[model samples]
Target: MRILFASSEIHPLMKTGGLADVSASLPVALKRLRHDIRLLMPAYPQALARAGKLESMATVTLPGFPDDPVTLLSGMLPGTRVPLLLADAPRCFQRAGDPYRAMDGQDWQDNHLRFGLFARLIEHLSLERTPLGWRPEVVHCHDWQTGLAPVMLGMHETRPVTAFTIHNLAYQGLFPRHAFDALNLPPELWHYQGLEFHGQMSFIKGGIAYADHVTTVSPTYAREIRTQQLGNGLDGLLNHRAESLTGILNGVDYKEWDPGRDRHIAANYGPEDFSGKALCKTDLQDHFKLRGTSGVPLLGHVGRMVPQKGVDLLLRAAEPLLAAGEAQLVVVGTGSSALEQAARRLAERHPGRVGVHIGYDEGLAHRVEAGADIFVMPSRFEPCGLNQMYSLRYGTVPVVRRTGGLADTVVDADPAGLKAGDATGICFDAALPEALTDALTRALALYHQPDLWRRLVRTAMAQDFSWARSAEAYATLYRDLVAARVPPGKP
Candidate 1:
């Protein structure tokens, strides 16, 4: 099978979140299955710097984009033989800071145009116009950044199969009406059956409305987004297309997350001999400058401090626990100015008991997973969470709200669940602070029972959330898609 995976970010080259991790790892996994997979992303300064040797391939031009003659660069993914395509449009990507934002947190005003050119590049590549000489039978896109590819593909009389994965529905890439004029899209796209959502044009709606098939990050999320509460007004479209939609949970690259060989943690241990976890706990406490013994429970959090993640719930739950000195909390993330300030204020209020690092550090994230007795993710809605999976692998029991992928992955640590020997972590039903605290309270109580706690840790460690199962599922989907694309008279 010949496929091209398109995403805004690719790990080790450029990254802002789990999308990059998926973009990088999934292709590698697919390539291992003996499929010809090509990876496509824009040439951000970071991607260009890390990309090994680059060969100029072809130049591209989009109708609305004034920046004509954007160059394309071809290279290989680092440490792999897989081909990589980089759209070298300086005006669009060669800005300061990361791919999506500048040094200031505000989005670049011309993002619609920026990603417009990127989608155009994908369309051209999917058509095999470049010198790289590989035509993709299937073009799989990720998120709203590549949403326009499906819309653009719809215009072709004989185009390859297209699949679009919605990583997050909340970020629909809603652009103003004026931007649509700048996009130079077909006027018919302005209708509700196309890209238009209310008064604005949605980049995601383009994919959802026209793609050959659609996917979310998890099976539970696949169902959730069909509801008014979680769909963000796309429920009708999602429900209509439910037959073509699938939910494949995101997988972790255990080579980067495994505790047995992790270079980031203070100590390494496996399920058989996890005595080193206590040392990691002590080191984590020391790093946070918290006064604590190994006996004290430590809760860990790593992600955006946005309301969607229910960070407010986490804060509210932490207040009672931190005030009573029941446990120590360590948070590592950067999002929402108000949440950042609130996390710092909580740290200040509790001094040594609360440690908040208002930024992302990959190494520190691994240490938290390896060290903390409990991993907290109280997301109001999670599509498919990666950290909870990492927590399970690290033997750090996760405390999560029963929603989306969190619901699919974590097994609630109720008495019946434990007795049945299937419990992997703690789960709360409601997305409320009190619900989270109740789950945490249960986790803390369970922590005092050494035998039960050790059993739970081993159970978590024993579970597998690696790429193999999910990759096989994707490979099956790709095969089905390719078969479906064949003409009725042909094989």
Candidate 2:
């Protein structure tokens, strides 16, 4: 099947989080499965400069917004056979540093206009009858940034079936209703059944309302988002489309994350030897200037420091845990001034007990995964996280909040020891500091029991959450969607 996978970000090109990783790895995996897959994203100046595809292709202007003509650029994605189409419009996309941000660290206020335009361009390209025909059988939209694609397709006279995947529900791309004219969205789509949300235009709602299928990262999150608590206000719409909604758990790119071949870490080790992991642990300690001790369990967190990630809970639990001195903490990744300041303060208070790196370092992240005894992801609501899976691959037990993908992935340690060999990590219910404390205490206690800890590590490492498996599942879904399009008796 010919598939057009649309996402705002792609790894090794423009990545801020796991969405980019999924966008890049999944398409490559699908291509390997013999399906013709093409990727569509903004030709950010940085990406173009890196890929060496700055030259312009065809310049096409939209109907409503005639003043802005978007230039299309064609290039092969680096390290992949799939073709890439970049929608270039310097006024809309060209900015310093990151694709989504300026050098001064501010989001482009015209993001709504930018992405909406990209969606419109995609619809036009797909529906246009050109000599180089490229009509996709399936148009897969990733996250809210590209959510407008499905909506635009539904409004158009296009035959391509649309699929929308919710990587994160919290960011729904809600813009003022007046911007509707700028979007060039049809009048008929203004109603609640389409893109309307309250008095604003919701990109995510449009995708949910119009797409043939809606998917979240994990099955448990698929169920959770239907409830008011976790839905971030889209629960009603998701509940209405519950039958069409499916949760497909995301998988990591084992080639990039596997400790066996990772050159980023101080030492490379796999399940066989396992001794190098300890060396990595010591290296991590030395790197962070923390106490280089193997007896105390080292817990690591690598992600954006924000309330959504439950960083506040980590802060609350830090002092007590450090005071107890049973375990050490190492946090990587940066976001939210409040969280960064708090983490840094905690590190200052307990020098060797807490190590906080207030920035993103890919190499450091891999080292943390290999070295840490436990990986902590206390997210308040995680759609589908990749780090926990990375931790599992690195033989690090994950201590996660029992919500969204975390609930789906981590099998809690059996209290009665009934499922001895199967348990992967510690899972907590409440998204509070006390709950996190309790879970940490349990993990630290288990760390002392070498046999149990080893069993947990082995169990986690044995699990396979590779993109190859995920791609196969997606292929089946795509084939099914295509088969449904066939006439009743036609082969």
Candidate 3:
């Protein structure tokens, strides 16, 4: 199979979240399955800096795009043979700060035009086979940023089958109603069935309405998005298009996440022995300036400090938990100004017991996974979370809310599950602080039981969350979509 994997971000190239990791790992995994895959993303300053020796392929000028010309750059995905394409338009992508945002947290003003042009760029490259003589059998779009490709492709007489994967539904690429006219999108796309959503232009709806198939990151999220609670206003449309929806769990690149050979952590340890984990714990405490012995339970969290992330729940529970000194909590990554202030304040008040870092560090993330006795994610809703899977691989028991991918990945350490020797982590139903605290209480109890803790860790390590499984599923999906689509000759 030949695939043009398109995304706004790809790890090491440009990453704001898990989508980049998926964009990087999935293609490499697919390539191993004998599929010819090409990765496409913008050539942001960060990506260009990291990209090794990019060769210019072609220059692209499209109708209604920004005046700046887009130069297509070709390279290989680092450490892999997967072909990489970068749309190099300096004015559109070479901004000072985050890809989607300015120095302040507000989104870039020209976002609609930028990604509108980007979508057109992808469509042009895939349609024309500009760089090389390889045309894709499937044009796989990721998230709302690439949503326009599928809609535009559906109108082409000769075009590859399209598949769109929604990494997170909450961000639907909504622009003001005027964007439809400003960006010069066809007036027809302003209808309810196309890109328009409740009088606003929604880039994601383009994919959902026109793609041959739609997918979310997890089976539970696939179902969750069809409901009003988690849909973020796309539920009705999703429910109408339910049959075409599929949920495939996101896979972590175990090669990068494996504890046995992880160079970022304090010590290397696998399921076997795991003695180095103690040293890692000591290092974690020392690094956080916590005066705690290895025996104290350490809770680790890494993600945005938002209400959705359930960091609020963690903070609420921490008030009582940290006060008693039963455990030490360490958190890294920044978001939500109020939450960031709250975290800093908590850390300041309880110096050693509560350590907080307001920015993301990959090395520290790996250390948290390897060193912590319990990993925490109390998400109100999650779409195929990667950290819980990472914690499982690192033999760090995850305490998570049973929603979306967390539900699919973690088997709660209940009595029956424990007896079956299949319990991998602790799960709570509600996203409330009480429920989270209860799960943490359970995790602390399990921590005291060394034999049980070891069992859980071994089971977690034994579980396979590798890309091979997801890649196979995606390969099968591509084949099914291609076979099921109307033949180029007929319709």
Please give the CA lDDT of all the candidate structures.
Answer: 0.90, 0.85, 0.90
Positional deviation of 103 in candidate 2, in angstroms? Answer: 4.1
TM-score of each: 0.98, 0.95, 0.98
Which 10 residues in a row give candidate 2 its minimum summed lDDT? 125-134
Question: Model 3 over residues 1-491: C-alpha lDDT tens digits?
Answer: 88999999998777778998999999999999999899999999999999898999888678787587899899998878999998899989989878899988989988988898888887887787465677888999999899998987887878889999999998899999888888887788889888889888999988898999999999999999999999999899999999999999999998899999999998899887799998898888889898865567999999988888899899888778888878889999888999999899889888789889898788899999998889999999999999999999999999999999999999999999999999999999987889998899999999999998999999999999899999999999999988887567764
What is the lDDT, from 0 to 100, of the residue 174 in candidate 3? 93
Task: For candidate 1, give the lDDT of residue 29.
Answer: 87
lDDT for each residue of candidate 2 in 1-491, tens digit (9 for 90 to 100): 88998888887778889898999899999999998888888878667776654445688887655767888787778877878888787777887756656666777777788888878877777676322367888989988788887877776554788889999998888888877867767788888887888889888887888888888889999999999988888898899999889899998888899999998888889887799899999999888899976588888999999899999998887678787787799999788988999999989889898999988887898899998989999999999998999999999999999888888788888675426567888999898999999998888888899987898888888988988888888888887777876667864
lDDT of 1 at 388: 97
Candidate 1 lDDT over residue span 131-234, tens digit each: 66778889999999999999999899777899999999999999999988888888988998988899998999999988999999999999999999999999
Point out where model 1 deviates above 4 Å: 488-491
- Distance (Å) between predicted and true CA of 223, model 2? 0.4
**Ranking of models by lDDT:** 1, 3, 2
Look at candidate 2 and give me any clashing residue pairs. none
Instruction: For candidate 3, give the lDDT.
Output: 0.90
Cα-based lDDT at residue 51, candidate 1: 97
